[model samples]
Target chain A: MTPITADATSLFDKLWQARLIKDLGDDRGLIHIDRHLLHDLSSPQAFAGLRQAGRPVRTPALQVAVPDHIVDTMPGRGDATVRGGADMIVALRRNAVENGLRLFDIGDPRQGIVHVVAAEQGIVLPGMTVVCGDSHTCTLGALGCWAFGIGTSEVEHVLATQTLVIRKPSSMRIRVEGRRGAGVTAKDLALGIIRAIGINAAKGGVLEYAGPAVTALSMEERFTLCNMGIEASARSAIIAPDETTFAYVRDHCGSPEWLPVATEAWTMLRSGPQASFDREFHFNCTDLAPQISWGTNPGQTIGIGDAIPPLPEPSAPRERASAERALAYMGLAPGQRLEGLPIAKVFIGSCTNSRISDLAAAARIVRGRHVAPGVRALVVPGSSRVKAEAEHLGLDRIFIDAGFEWRESGCSMCVGMNADRVAAGERCVSTSNRNFEGRQGPGARTHLASPATAAASAIAGHIADCRQVAGR
Target chain B: MKAFRKVTGTGVPLGRSDIDTDAIIPQQWLITTSREGLGKGLFSNWRYRDDAFTPDHGFVLNEPRFARAKILVAGPNYGCGSSREHAVWAHLDFGIEAIIAESFGPIFRDNALRNGLPAITLDGAAVSQVLAQLAALPANRMTVDLERAEVTGPDGTAYRFTMDEERRRALLDGIDDISATLAHAPDIDAFHSADRIRNPYYWVQPPRD
Candidate 1:
């Protein structure tokens, strides 16, 4: 148990203190949200509540707005280019400007998915509280911030007061030790964690990710880890910011004359070597392989070479009957091998893995290979900026040359908010998080994997190991 | 806000499942976080494309019979996608009060319940039967009783279903989750006051196994 703050603390204390979590009493902990990011999805209601209350925003500067979904992420464009999607994004800009909030509208060079851009810009500092309407807000926790998703009304409350009345969550520390294999990426690690802990099992719990393997990850990788915490039903996922974090922030946000002062403050952000949690889970990444979800939930996953888990024995008939129903609904056979499952589509984009590094990995796999005949492979960047960077590096050409559709960013196909979608009954190897039934599109079957695996599956037209491919 | 003891509407015929937020209200309309005047953008793309409803013949909202639909009868696995609360708001603005589907996405269901939208799921075949019954009649009338959790169709036939009791109570009381949680504020405050003990050295060292 961590000590509660000696002084009366603000609602956002843990973030301001650079502490993982100080006890807030009972099972709750006082954590902070460093940055409050907004998107079109949850902002409207929040703003509505503020209007109803006749309250003015306490600190608009701390709140930022970006539009990544419900807009077209087409190549060389922003939300404005996507027909009417621009109108909403533009409205956010107007609201931001009028309310004195920071706005990153479509076409802004810095714009992308809220989470991706937050890390890349160094806006997500360690020991900060970051809240957003999007569940993937946990992505910022990788930078050592306590970021998570909130409801629309909660957003309104935070905007009006620059504070949140939150219940302290129980803490759960998950430590992954050892080094990873060449093909095993942060995505695989996340998938592995989800598989170990069933979805919704981590509900109301704060998950702190640590250990040597976590320390070795880049800021991008940490983002991947924290992003999936929501899928596990965890309140938040955090990793203590280290030199790599400091370096990334300095490189992107810039280290100025006041850097030394900020650094001194940042040094105190880590867990004081003695921090404890309510629960702990450990993993040895040395033998971890690229992972994929074969069933309806992220927890129902198997390693690259492993087979799907056979139906578990429920103590009674009714519970066993439900398990059978789940298997049937998921269209999976107990003990069936997960590899070589035929796939019709491959999607690589989402806040989960749409960064430049994610694209680079896919580009490597598709460099000299063509997508399997009859397969539809689409690569949607997380934001316009990511698309631009990928094009700058000619990643679009590589994907297109390999017969994959290099389309716009936005949350395409990841959640079926845009035009991109999987046909009914189609099986897709996707880089997006979540393998929930019909999540991508109605009646579509989703197999969650890393970008490399998705790209490799596109080439092989089946679930294949990315490392087995030539050159990559 | 006037209390709606009874909700009545014409059911729209839509067979598509997992109708995500993007399809409900495309990203193009999400620019302003303002909740005002969202009715026009609701189903904007599907309503008008190329100055004509693209796939005009098959688009559910374009059907002449259900032109003023206020209740949507959809297939299984409805509302599967990003947990944007906007989708529910768009539906409500478009005059939707009750959604009858085979099943619903968890987050979307929660959002709808919070906003007084009733997301009721039934057996897929049962929903198809209700849709067929509605389709068989021209300009069918549908009535949903919030207090009873029942839907009456054109022929005065009633379809009964279940809703999460907790959500039903909140909706009946017109309280969102935030308000519901706030109701326990005094209790939560007491918990904090009574449980302020802390560990001395957990921040710097791992806890003992």
Candidate 2:
């Protein structure tokens, strides 16, 4: 990265300049990692590597660990509670203890998914460069940070040295203007974007969201939107930190004495007036409806009111074949509407949409209704604080009384590493990000949607829109 | 990490898009601490029949003709969804040395390069030409020469691609990334001490117990 010239810089360029340690040549830089989050599934190997190499974590104070991926979501669960997860959790604990890193153990109130905890505890502040081993680490970009995921090898590099060799991705701005409809949400906005544009539209670039519709979203909604950066093939996504971001950070940012200094610094985290991106995509969310994935991939989506598209014509042979396979695996016919399709299960949790506000949105839809007779519904909060806040506000009671199971926080049903998997061949409407074939479980068909849609689908035993459920 | 120079082997064509890591290796096999012996679980969903491990003859990997395949020619976004290194490990352990696709998930590409597995990108027309040749004659030989930055297809078509200079250099020389960063520790530490004040809230002061 060159020194800032008279040219107005984009938000990504600004963040890149702040975090760059040195330009290691070849368009790659040795960037300093301000905060590093670790989880059970990917960190054990990295810690093991550190042990083998006799290298200590360069900055343990900037690192934190929480076992979320393979942990059981059952109430009163412990480290040894999960069948295949106990050893991973134990390994993370041992590694954290050995490295002098903070570990949110099973009983700790802060124990949760890595992304959610970073937001709720202020582990990731605005304008910093954060990274984790999981792909959804981009979710932290909601706070106007350059956060993205890395693989296990990259994770090991980060542990041994608090720097990474990252290629500076070109900047791309996705501006969502106008007003989204009543029931449409950030989840819907993300799916609609992916559907309108091919997943590779933002490939090899860092995406920055702009425009009034994006700024109007709540912080939690912004988290959900940025979390799907990987789905659109972007390195990461960021929204300029505004009043909503400052208020949220102020609530959890420890050391009130330092918040002013931090906030003042964050104020400069926006793009310049004449900032230009390498590419730009502008969308109007006025007619965007709550999106539902009809096929296996996130891009294979349609609005709730629309029917599944027919197979692509022979002109695009590759597209035609892919659609054929997705249709066969999903057990759906062409031109069939996503609504009124019978679903066997409902999952309303993930790093994507398991926050307190997500639960409240679902609660409003399921307020006075009972789940359908045959549908099994589960709601797992994203973090301990989220679960506690939902209970304090009686959202948990509304879900439980309405026949949805209230579960402890973890990555439940989203990845289904625990015992919360959907049975084989069963169809489920989930709030998680990916809908790949057998992502929920082998032979399980998943329809990715928002929490509100998941809750309403559970009540109706079929795909249903929250707007109609709320009689809006 | 192994050093990559060149490889000549038969190629298998997987004509599918959005082949996510979840499909490459399922979530059930992700609990292990080690990445060894994952070849058995590579595309287990598509390759095996029932819990009894009956090899499905329909899947290309299970077919006898492509048993010695060392290169995978696949559709776009070959390794999308989830930042699982197990996808690269499984492919490497399953006797595949490199993957040539229309495009790949950026994280997967980085992981592959770090592990000495080259993720070569070719345009759609080039990928189709290669896949069509493999479909007609499964035993046709192919070559991926990293030094030359070119891939020789079964039909004698050579497609050139580009890669980041630093990553390509490291993979070719098998350079240890951790040690490389450590060699420059002085630079990192200097920046850390100098910029610590700018991010006052980013540091944690509570002592670790």
Candidate 3:
């Protein structure tokens, strides 16, 4: 392949400059960006840094700002209920308007989780470099774009220079084969992938999903997989564009440019049957059970009903030390059964698996079942649009009737960013990524699981295998 | 504005492993855009009952000894999950001068430095020892001397550490990196005005192949 190095922008470089790229794939194979995402959390200092540099945003019109992380999840109206959430919305709106960018204010039908709305509105297209201040920006990989999270300074750098300096990442290809097991959704497939390679295995590289199983997934399912790339410690995850992707974009966006731009870029993105990867891992979906992380890290996972791995004889001092420490904090015995380990809460929302599909999965479990006594369960939607769609289908009622709190969208309980949190010493089976200590709150314990597993845990009041309850 | 200056303070011992950011300032607090007074909200859910503003007896922050902690002694892989700087700021706002952990999540540590909070890592055992000492004497004062690259506890036991020399210099001078970047305004203006090329990454490249 001829190296095409044209005078174009890289996504990271554009983030530094805070400018929009005219096109992607300059003859050099580097992709430029059409839009950038700014949020309340990362954009404040970016603006401050720009002020310090005495420059306005390069192309604010191409930028979009929304509040997702800190927004309150309470559904009630009135100033107090919207208190903290409204302030950030006000600040973001002020910032966007001042910078000449578009502001999607709270309550606007267009207002939803940034990634979901971006894909739904066709703002994120195939073959674009989309940088957001949030790491889950990798979700756009489902759209065939190179999107990932960046830092506050990097946000400023992009705003001021519209470019970021970055080294091209090495690549890792994860090929999923065979049809998915009945009742096994994309959440299971993603957890299965993370379990196989370990979270840090894909770090510093771009991971591409291929093979029949991945292609067989819906756009929502693919998004669910790629969206959690950050949780796997990877730089990003991308799925080769296909008819389903084009259809999703076309149907949601309905623009003349969708087909033309998608068709053109999708062709360039596939790993030419002979393309190479720095590393490769393959999985057979047929045998994989609904997966979940029983330990404190996403990598400390096991199949449903499997006991925690006996502390592997530490081949190295670090591994031994880590195992000893993990065992101590989680109050678990090596080789202890993860089943029936009582839980205090169940959280089912995050950029990782909180799409509409995830809701449906949880609803299926919660439909006729009440949460086991004392297990505080909440079902948070990923975006307002997702919430609306689920509500339209009465999915919210299914959960609410089953004693789950149906709340508004945002990264709720995923990172413990807002008021929703698991109490200290409280254990939870969560559908979001990352089970690191205190992820739900100080001294709180997290067990990462799929929506189905989380719902099962809610019913059993512990870590129960979904297949046992959902019945394969 | 005053120049950024190095801050020296006592290290509070938390001694817990895998202390992720979600625990630092749970996600429920991220909704508001206000950066002011987040210290109160930091670890709030754990410290207080859901509807009760008073302290929760079982929570870490509510524990008598750690009520006024200013420095955290943590285990490995601290600050994992979403790159929200709010977690870092909440810690800083709560008067946490430094975090002594086994390691840090890449972006979370960077966010700490940019906001004047230094996340220092040392041997896990060493951190545990510090935690024990702090537990033995809850009010034990430990100083983080950036100039000396050392942290000394109330008992005078010292641990050697390292920080980015540039960031250290900036902190000691009380100036942020962005301010430092701007101090070279004349050079930057000259560079931008020169025959610069735009790279594929959208950054202005120096005029050269």
lDDT (CA) for every model shown?
0.71, 0.88, 0.70
Chain B TM per candidate, please? 0.83, 0.95, 0.80
For residue A281, give model 3's deviation from the true position in Å. 2.9
TM accuracy, model 3? 0.74
Candidates ranked, most accurate by lDDT first:
2, 1, 3
The CA lDDT at A466 in model 3 is 82
Model 1 residue runs over 4 Å out of place are A1-33, A76-87, A314-326, B1-83, B86-209
Indicate which candidate wins on lDDT: 2
Q: Per-residue lDDT for B1-209 in model 3, tens only?
A: 12333344445555554455666776656665445677877766556766456878876556766666677777666676667777877887887777777667656776677677777777767777787787787456776777787777657888888766665665667664444344444544444434134222122111111
Q: Residue B76 deviation, candidate 2, in Å?
A: 1.2
Q: Measured against the native two-chain assembly using Cα atoms, what DockQ does each of the candidate structures obtain, in the order listed?
A: 0.11, 0.64, 0.20
Q: What is the C-alpha lDDT profile of model 2 across B1-209, one tens digit per residue?
A: 78898999989999688798999999887888887888888898898887777998999988777888899999998898889898898999899998999899888888899899999989988998899999896456999998999999997889998877777778789888899889989999989987877665666543223
lDDT of 2 by residue, A1-472 (tens): 9876654898889898889999977788899998889999988878877888888889988889999999888888887644667999999999899889888888788989899998888778889899999988888899999999999999999988899988888888988998988989999999999888777777757889889999999999999999988889886889999989999887776447877877888888888878988888999999999999989889999999899898899999888998999999999989999899999999999999999989998998999899999999999999988999999999998999999999888998999778889888899999999888888888889999999899989999999988888721
lDDT of candidate 1 over B1-209, digit per residue (tens) = 12344678788877654455555765545545466566666666567654343535556777777778888888655664456677777888888888888866545665677677888877766787788887787757888787887888777878787865655666777764444344444544443333222211111111110
User: Model 2 Cα RMSD, Å?
Assistant: 2.4
Report backbone clashes per prediction. 31, 0, 51
Q: Give the per-residue Cα lDDT of candidate 3 at B207.
A: 18
